[model samples]
Target: MKIELAENYGFCFGVKRAIKIAEDNQNAATYGPLIHNSKEIARLEKDFKVGLTDDYKIFKAGDKAIVRTHGIQKQELQELKDKGVNVVDATCPYVTKPQEIAQEMSEKGYSVVIFGDDEHPEIKGVKSYATHGALVVTSPEELEGVKLHEKIALIAQTTRKVEDYMKVANYLIPRYKEVRVFNTICNATFENQDAVRKLSKKADIMLIIGGKNSSNTKQLFKISQENCQNSYHIEDEKDLDFSWFDNKNLCGISAGASTPDWIIQNVIDNIKSKIS
Candidate 1:
């Protein structure tokens, strides 16, 4: 069997930069997991003694605190600073754009609509910036009965699928008088998803490597599964079942933006070993 990797997979600029920020600030404590990968968090904890905590109340003065790439609520960050915690912001620039847009739109008297999961950390952070608070919608149907202002602003979580966001925008544009759409999806996310869509045509089986909780990884897995029924989302080699690859002549590999090259390599090596 031939093994091929996706055109764009593994760590993106934001994730690589976030990991570097954690490494540079040894003995620091991130406000949350710096990124979504558990193995990478464990590596940081073991190698640099960087701890992870989601609560701002527990952090003390003179201690270092790194903001997650998904960012945090504005009030929570302010509270951390007020407590004299040395803050090292590792928020991805892509995630910050939507927050700024949400705040500005709300300030201008426009009702804001975010196309993403309400419970996601990024969405929570972005919603806090909206002056009038924003409506979170995962689909166009979610917007059906919600009352809206004449002027409306639309944005999406950095990792959500482009098509899904567009679906909501398409539904709103016709109904709303003035609609402003910001393509807030990260460039890396677009590339990864596009690459998976391309890989779906050539491979018999697909392995998507990333943490189960990773949104971007889940998107890739979903995109792949839609086109190829033999797709599997696995965190690492341990999750791989040999039977999935049985009689498969070609296998494709893809990883989320948060996934490190080492994990991808290990999974690739393991898959190749089983092939023979």
Candidate 2:
């Protein structure tokens, strides 16, 4: 069985940069885990005294706070700064664009509607950008029975699926008076998902490697499962079950934006070795 791998399925630019900064400033206490991957976070925590917390109480004196690539809420940022926290912002530039757009729309007296998971770190951060409070909706159904303003601005989470974003956008366009769409889905996310779609076509079984808690990883797993029923989402080699690979001919491997290449390679190597 020949294994196929996605060209654009691994750690993205945002994740790479964040990890590099964490390593360079090993002593600095990051406000959150630099990225979502537990493996990387574990490694960093071991070497660096990087502390992860949303609470402001832990920060004092010379302690520096590093923001994750997903970004942080405006109020949180301000509060940290006010507390004399030395902040090293690692927010991805692409993720910051939607926040700026939402802020502009809110300042112009338009109602901002963020189309993404509300509880997600990125969405929460984007909400802080709006001068007026922004509304977050995960899907069209969530907006049901709710009255929309005449002038509304729309933005998406950086890791959202493009098709899903369009579905929600089209659903609202007809109901709202004025709607502005800003495609904020990260380019790396789109490319990674696109690569998985391409690989799924040629492979018999698909393996999505990433942290199970990772939203981007879940999205990738869902995308792969849609195209191939034999797809499995696993964090590491230990999560792999031999039964899932029984009689499989070819396996395609892909990963999320936050997943490190070393982890992906380890999973792939383990799976290949199991092939009799």
Question: Which residue pairs clash in candidate 1?
Answer: none
C-alpha displacement of 45 in model 1, angstroms? 0.6
TM-score of 1: 0.98
Q: How would you encode candidate 2's per-residue C-alpha lDDT over 1-276 as one tens digit per residue?
A: 577898789888988898888877767776666788889888888877665776656877567889898888898888888888888888988888988998999999888989888888888889999997898988888878877678889899988898988988898889888889888888899999999988887778999999887999999899898889999998888998989877888889999888988898898788779876
Q: Which candidate is the best by lDDT?
A: 1
Candidate 2: C-alpha lDDT: 0.85
Per-prediction count of colliding residue pairs?
Answer: 0, 0
Cα deviation of 163, candidate 1, in Å:
1.1
Error of 1 at 107 (Å): 0.8
Candidate 2 Cα deviation (angstroms), residue 177: 3.3
- Worst 10-residue lDDT window, candidate 1: 267-276
Model 2 Cα RMSD, Å?
Answer: 1.5
- Put down candidate 1 lDDT per residue, 1-276, tens digits, no spaces: 799899999899998999999999998999878889999999999999999987878889999999999999998988989989999999999988898999999999999999999999999999999989999999999888889999899999999988888999999999999999999999999999999999987899999999999999999999999989999999999999999888898899999999999999999888778777
Candidate 2 residues lying further than 4 Å off, grouped into runs, are none
User: Which candidate leads in TM-score?
Assistant: 1
